[model samples]
Target: MEDKEFDKLTPEEKKARFQKAVDDYNSGFVEVDYTFRSVASIRVEEAMEDAGRVSEEFKPAQIKVIYEAAKADLNLEHYMNPKFSASHMKFIMEQEMAGKDVTWLPIGKILHRSIVDKPLTRDQIRRIKERMQRAEPKDSVIADLHEKKKEAARVPKKQGQQKKKGER
Candidate 1:
């Protein structure tokens, strides 16, 4: 199917197709292996714990400064390195001191909210709102799928049990 044609399907139909594909793949009709590399799991856990201490009053400007410094500290290229720098380390410590919710959220989301909350020219606001409206359908579909998945996960399945006809 062409991409545009696929995009025209009702949300439920798209989900049903996705679920069937996953079920088939899981049953070994398709062979797939995925590998991912990331920072050590223990370190990631420790960082998350440290980030949790940042206060709600934390400033984005301060966070940006720390982020820049962190990029410098690990001798990472501006775009490729991940370790925190001395400045970032200090910011994290300050956040911890302030007793704030410093749990890290994806930077793009943080930036998006910051931008939308600020005063904007009428034209800018209109453009942003239009873009957001265009994006809403996809977001709604994703949310619906998440709810469905959660419902499915919560349902208990009996051992050695066969799914009833039409269950899938």
Candidate 2:
């Protein structure tokens, strides 16, 4: 309603309108926005604990939203070579400080796939990248193993699969 029209109403009519709005809100007819909260309002430690306790069956989207909000509110940045988010690191730190199990959180595992403390050294990454970029045939060891299997398969299976004499 326009302010002018509302101002024209009697006090009793205004009260009735306010009551109807409240009723609509209470009845789920209105979506009351609760997203105004800031990350500063969150207790990081508590959020970590709660996240740790999240059920394994919870959807990834749910976890993502929760974590995304936490990350945004804190204005956290990614860290380390693998680019782990600050929110993830904070949660792990909180769990560690409390002596809680830090390894098995479903959300944590989803958010940080590697979950490694020490990131791979630059040399290691460089070597891996170089190896991947190489034009040589890959999997030499597996290639030999597969060749051996093919050779074995090519040989006919003798009756009873008897071992040759003196072949220990």
Candidate 3:
């Protein structure tokens, strides 16, 4: 409210803390989402729980499997930043999802893109199912490297080392 309007409040109204707060809120002066109570609200809670459900949606064990895939692909490595929550990372997984865009949406708006209040569409389900299925078997890249070394050892080395200049 403008200073003039605030000043016009009766001395008793100004002195009454809770009522003043309510009046500001009804006047659209207060931001409700930042309040502690918002954490338990449906949208906030969904955004919180969404961090896990997306990965667990397709396969129970695929979280680790997808991490392994990210370890192998340099292109996706940047988005694996420890600073971002898991749900934020999922939004950037594919080139189309968010690319470099960051969302300012409140949880209610974000839930539309996520599988919370509303169920995922058929195509969304199919695509996520296929993507998870395509990841390499969990923890296999290091094993593949080990196998490469084993295969190299199985081949014979040269019979003699290269001769140095007239030493013998």
For candidate 1, what is the total of clashing residue pairs?
Answer: 4
Model 3 Cα lDDT, one tens digit per residue, 40-85: 2333224325453343343423344335334334233323233444
109-154, model 1: which lDDT tens digit per residue?
2234323122335465456445544444555777868866887899
| lDDT-best of 2 and 3 | 2
List TM-scores for all candidates, in order.
0.18, 0.22, 0.18
- Candidate 1 residue 73 C-alpha distance from true site, Å: 42
Give the candidates in order of lDDT, highest first: 2, 3, 1
Quote the lDDT for 73 in model 1. Answer: 34
TM-score of 3: 0.18
Model 2: per-residue Cα lDDT at residue 44: 30
What is the alpha-carbon lDDT for the whole of candidate 3? 0.44
Identify the runs in model 3 with alpha carbons over 4 angstroms from their true place.
17-39, 42-168
* lDDT measured at residue 106 in model 3 versus the true structure, 0 to 100: 24
C-alpha RMSD for every candidate: 27.5, 15.9, 16.6
Model 2 alpha-carbon drift over 4 Å, by segment: 31-168
The pairs that clash in candidate 3 are none
Reference-based lDDT, each prediction: 0.44, 0.47, 0.44
